[model samples]
Target: MTLLQAFVTLPVLLPMLGAAASVIVSPRASLQRVIGVVTLALVCVVAGVLLVSADSYGPVVAQLGGWPAPMGIVLVADRMSALLLLISTLVTLAVLVYAIDQRISDYGRETASTTFHPIFLLLSTGVSLAYLTGDLFTLFVAFEIMLASSYVLITRRTSASRIRSGMTYVIVSLMSSLLFLTAVGMVYAATGSVNLADLAGRVGMLPEGLKTVLALLLVVVFGIKAAIVPLHFWLPDSYPNAPAPVTALFAGLLTKVGIYALLRTQTLVFPQDHPSTLLLVIAAVTMVVGALGAVAQDDLNRLLSFLLVSHIGFMLFGLAVYTPSGIAGTALYIVHHITVQATLFLVSGLITRRTGTVSIAQMGGLAQTAPHLAVLFAIPAITLAGLPPTSGFVAKLALLRAGAGATPAAEIVAAFVVLASLLTLYAVARVWVRVFWGTPKEPLVDNDPNDELVVGTARSARGMYVGASSLIVVSIVIALFAGPLSAIASRAGDDLQTREAYRSAVLGPDTAPGGPGPVPVAAVPQGPAAAGGGAAIGAMTADDAEGTTSR
Candidate 1:
């Protein structure tokens, strides 16, 4: 393997190694924290290098076990995947710091030992693997890794309510995993290959009915993960029950990973020539439903969770358009949302620290005493609402431009986009009025000792602030660099549309789809071939053999 190819694996390998090391060093709280932080920091740096390499030199392909694509595990760091990886690693690093500080403040340095660091690193590894994997089966494994780690994180130091909510989360996640596995099986059964580059060439050749079923099945599976609309019921309950930092990490990374998978698979395996009417309608409904849900929520985390679900529709809006501009817009929105959503959740953590309650009704006059906190909340809130001069506005504007097409579906969904933004602004404004603008109120003290409501020591609070502010700065930097980022996103969109660049990167120029010899078509049954018979099976097998021999 070349140097660049080897570097791609570090993001995954380093974290797995670090997780094991963290396990061995368990109960050494300081060392575990350093290992987790340093591991993520290294990943962040590696991801940055990958983004640069991919943007400048095309995709970085690493075929593991010295095997080739369509046969062995492959990791491809394309422009899109590399960009998302960098952002994810940075967010994970920030959330880890915040968690460490929170732990120290709530339960001293010695008590901050055991399962947390290892599991968190494992989750980071899963996230990196998910983005970099070049096939479906590996992606499933990555999801399982993340789910296992997240389950432990959510239920770790919890009350009865959190445990119950964790159960809901686990159950829902397991169901989606089963569906995802089934989809992978169906795709492999039909195409004889699960590698994305291989599937790119073969899936289109399947019977239209069978292809459509597989596509929709994959969509539903990812939709459950991404928390879009009707599938989003588990999120608000599940996320709000977790500790602040864990909620922030999940809010930012998990759903975006789901959306990334949707983008990668839909564009590669089930290429759409025109805007999907079904997706557009779904986007519209999700935006409205999630926004309305947010407006109705009394709890701060629950409201933010609803807004997270609502904004996912915006990203879906871009995918629904199925054009280069639309995809670019989606890419930009994903970057913006990942930063803004995580920042909002982190800021929510700070708010809870001060107010000692999740209810907006119980919070008041924070703008008077904690002006800095107000500033932190305002920036992300304005961004989340798609207001002027922010990353959210830039991303939303791109989507709007993409949506101004001749199609009626685009126009209708565009309207819903605007409606959702307005609702988001109103919801945040309500929080501002209730939580910041009113007369000062004492912190609400709950009887539950396990309730995640504590104002930490000044030093620890400073650590938490630093963590949250770092991401806030990141969101600002995204806004500042919107022009270049948008350009990069446009290029990424073009790459996805073309498909050949990715195929060549992973499968080698000689073996890439449409290169050398006839493209291998899967021996899937159709029409009379569907009937069970030795002759038909033998005929299909013979055809496949001929195709393989020709290659």
Candidate 2:
């Protein structure tokens, strides 16, 4: 095996090992933080190396213990996997810092300080492995790793409210896991193997009805994980109940994992299917539903949670189209959304820290008192709103441009996307007006006309803003480098569409899984953005909460 091939496993391997090390030193919080940060930082470095190797020499594939494909566990890294690896690692690191601060500063709440590092590291291990694994069951294992750790993290806060929400999350996640396992069983029973390369060929050859059935089963499972409409009810409740750091982590990475699986399976298993049409309908509904839900929420975290579901629809739009532009756009959007979403949540934590609540009506003129926080909030607020020159705008423009030339169905989906974008702006704008702008006004009516309002003493933690602002800077960096990033995304999209190189890379050029010849290496494509083809897309950030009590 080549050196690069060997390097492909480090992202998962290093983190797993580091988690063990962190556990050994778990009694020491400072040491644990150092270990966690160093370990994940190294993981990021390895991921960058793998990304460079993949970009230079097609998809990198490494078989575990020299076991061959379809039998041995395999690791594969291409532009997409590598890109996501970097994103996930960086986000986890930032959130780790934020979480550490929360544990230290918010001692009023229960914080599992000792177990946090190990569990968080394990969570990173799962996310890394999920991106790298080339076999279906291995992906399943990866999911469990993440889910198990997530269960602990979400339930770390011992309040009755959090426990109730955690139970809901656990039940829903268990159900999705069952669905995923069942779908895999069916796929294995039909295809005779579970390796992605093996299934790639087998999936295409299945009878039309079976193919559609299999695809939809997989879609439903991922749909739940991704929080698609009708399946997203758990998010608004479960997410907001977690501590702010956990909320940020779950919001940024968890649903995206579901989306990542969908992307992988969509290209490898059903490359030629017209499922995008169905996805378009779901996308339209998801967008409207999520945005409207966001509009109706008074809890800041819950409002963000609904918006999370809505934006997933945007990514769905790109994936549904099955074109180079569509996939690239989706990829870019995922990255943008992750950073901006995390930034907003981090800002949410900062706001709550100062005001003791996320209720907009209880908040009074944060802009005047905390100008630095206001500035931090404003950057991402505008970025998330799809304002000009921000990465969000660029990503949306790419999706719209791609859809503009697609089928009539795609055109209709595009209209819904535009409507959702405007509505998203309004939702964030409302937050700006209610939370950051005017006075903190009390309600005119109350429960039994006797409700009481509690105002918290505003306080600032030393390192909290540091961690939060880092993510805002990340979002800004993404916007600034939209061109190169889009080109890379375009290349990944092309590679996904041209599945030959991937299977051959993993299964070997000589014994390409489904073919009789050597796998041909493919070149990365330069995106339309390289030529400045579309209108400049910019972004803004927003989130808000308002109370419904009496004065």
Question: Cα lDDT of all candidates, in order?
Answer: 0.87, 0.79
| Residue runs of model 2 more than 4 Å from their true location after superposition | 108-112, 273-275, 440-457, 513-551
Cα lDDT over the full model 1: 0.87
Backbone clashes, each candidate? 0, 24
Candidate number of the best lDDT? 1
**Clash list (residue pairs), candidate 1:** none
Cα deviation at 284, candidate 1, in Å, is 0.6
Q: Residue-wise lDDT of candidate 2 within 1-551, one digit each (tens)?
A: 47878788888878788788888876677777778889988988888888787777788898999998867889999889899888888888888888777666655333336677888888988998888899888998899899999999888746667789899999999999999998887776555567887678655544566678889998898898889997899989899878778888889998998899999998887785343778889988999999999888887888889889999999988899888788888888888888888888888877766666767667667787778988988888788778888878987888898788788999999999899888888888888887878874432222221111111435446667888888888888988898889888899988887787788888777666545223221100111123232212100000000011111
